[model samples]
Target: MTLAHFLHGLRCASCGTLNALWLDLIRALVECHQCGQTALTLTDTDEGRSL
Candidate 1:
């Protein structure tokens, strides 16, 4: 299983629509793009601010 993060949220930069994808792997994350939506690209942060 993949590591789960609370930061599991995708914000459509185009239409500003927030969608949950982590919980749903069957659906394409960019499907909303056809309707003028952008997928929120996630950037993981260090567990303790790695130096």
Candidate 2:
């Protein structure tokens, strides 16, 4: 999936560390790279606003 956005300063729920996350717009998911946490799952409406 192509990355649509890069979200910075996101706190990971699993690791409790602030990290920059890659937003996969096609999948509507935002995941933490540091701890492999699925930080957010966005809906269609939310996806549009994110960009």
Q: Please tell me which predicted candidate would have the highest lDDT against the true structure.
A: 2
Error of 2 at 2 (Å): 1.1
- Could you say which candidate leads in TM-score? 2
- Per-residue lDDT tens digits of candidate 1, residues 1-51? 444332236664555556633322333234343244424444367655867
Off by over 4 Å in 2: 44-51
List the pairs of residues colliding in candidate 1: none
lDDT of each: 0.42, 0.71
lDDT of 1 at 1: 44
Clash numbers, per candidate:
0, 0
Off by over 4 Å in 1: 1-8, 20-29, 33-51
TM-score against native, each model: 0.28, 0.59
